[model samples]
Target: MGYLEDQAAVADGLLSLYEATFDPRWLDEIRSLVGEMLTAFWDDGSGAFFDTAKDQEQLVVRPQDVTDNAIPSGTSLAVDVLLRAGMLLGEPSWTERAQRTLERLAPTAAKAPLAFGHLLTALDFHLGPVVELAVIGDPGDSQTDRLLEVVRERFLPNRVLAAGAGPGAIPLLTDRQALGGKATAYLCEHFVCQTPTQDPGELARQLDAFRAKALAS
Candidate 1:
């Protein structure tokens, strides 16, 4: 059976893999999968993804599930994957589509928050502070490891992490270089970045402060 849920779950997992490993291959795979999902399952009139692909066996009615249950609804997972992946991969169209999906479900979600927990999570991410942390240095280096540890250990909501020896191919790492040939971390809010720092303590303090300010406001 060609179910939208299967494809959306795969895309969500791939997004996590990309975040954990920073491998562009995972991102590419997610992009392809999302493209296919949109082409095969999206309802243009409703801006929601159907449970079954349009090309699948015909049914009296094609159902679209928008509520979160034991597992997140396919559409909710799709929105989460698209939003995070778009931010990581520098793709605005994917994020826009995700936004549209949310708008389509807003009234229902607002009426029953408990029934739309997963969708609400995605909405929180969409409305939350977006932090992009880029570490520049050899991945195996101690300094780089320290910076990455700080990044991973921090409780950062709506955060994306990317590390490499140099700028590399990742959009977030573009033009990001280590200072004085030492590992450096660049923390950015929205699109504006703070000064690069090699000290893990400074990075922690900066990130904590940023999160505190966001929570306060």
Candidate 2:
């Protein structure tokens, strides 16, 4: 009730994002898992999602509201997944669910958009384009590690982070590998990709320049 709705909204945003990227595997997993997560805490009569799923074996009374200081709650993460799955998979059912969920959370965002930075970022994504980045390498390697670290510290909510080796790891990066000789970074915006960069400093500079331009627009 309290902030649970806000969390749902942000989650909707992120979900929409993941879907947009065609991560069917991720969607499949979330779709299978979220319902259980919800039932753990949800009170069927409340017409509101809870902070914790109703079925949580760990809690007596699962928290009923969302909470995130600079962002939305874990509830938001769930909602975002729902929203994004609809968009990415081109599923009307998913889209309808996301829209309904967002309608429920709209008032909160309207009343206090700043506090919900994650939700705001999601809203911004729909208005324009989002950039997706895949960083592949030893998550612990120094240079590849530094590159990923720097990217996250920046305000690039439009980007998604994945560390691994797979087809998903390709296309996104200009280079086929990351700095450690196996690591790689792929950047995409508006569904179009730019060459990936292996240089951590260059990636930072590139993102910095892009954000600066985005602000200007």
Candidate 3:
């Protein structure tokens, strides 16, 4: 019985892999998985996702459970990952779907906070300001590592990190240049960027200011 209950969690794992490795392949896989998830579980009329695939054995009632217990609900994980990967990839449709799902669950989540802990966290990412950090540098460069370290050491939750030599195929990395022929960092909020910097200290200051502003809101 190949039930499609954990696809959202699987997509989340791929997102984590992308963050850790900075390999676009993981993101690509996420995109592909998202398509499958939508096709199999998404119900436009209900604005919810079922745990079982559409092609699976028909039951008297399709199971659609969204509760955060020992493991986060598939719906919550789906929304979180969709928001994260969707923003990074510049895909508005994915975020829109995730938002609609949250819209349906908002009142329920409000009344049952303990049961919807993970879903609330996902909502935070949706409602909070998200920082987009694009680090452009050739691989194995110490300058690049330093700039990344400044960002990695922080406990920034609503931030997305994209690192590579150039824009490559990532929309977040596009148009971000390496100033002065050195490793550079571009910090943006909701895709509107700040001045690019090659120094790690300046990057840290920028991230700190951005974090401060995010908190202020």
lDDT of all the models against the reference? 0.85, 0.55, 0.86
State every prediction's TM-score relative to the real structure: 0.94, 0.55, 0.95
Best by lDDT: 3
Off by over 4 Å in 3: 1-5
lDDT (tens digit, per residue) of candidate 1 on 3-72? 8889989998887786677666786797789889889988777777899988888889888878899999
Compared with the true structure, what per-residue lDDT tens digits does model 3 show for residues 103-170?
A: 99999999989999999988999998888899998746899888889998999988888998878768
**Candidate 2 least-lDDT 10 residues:** 166-175
RMSD for each model, in Å, please? Answer: 1.5, 7.6, 1.5
Candidate 2 lDDT: 0.55
Error of 2 at 98 (Å): 3.0
Number of backbone collisions per candidate, in order? 0, 33, 0
Tens digit of lDDT per residue, candidate 2, span 1-217?
2234544454454454443343436555555454444454344454445665333354666664443465456555554554444344334554454445456766887888765656555556544445566666655567667767777788765554555444442234333455446666666564455677787777887778778777777
| Residue 14 accuracy (lDDT) in model 2 | 46
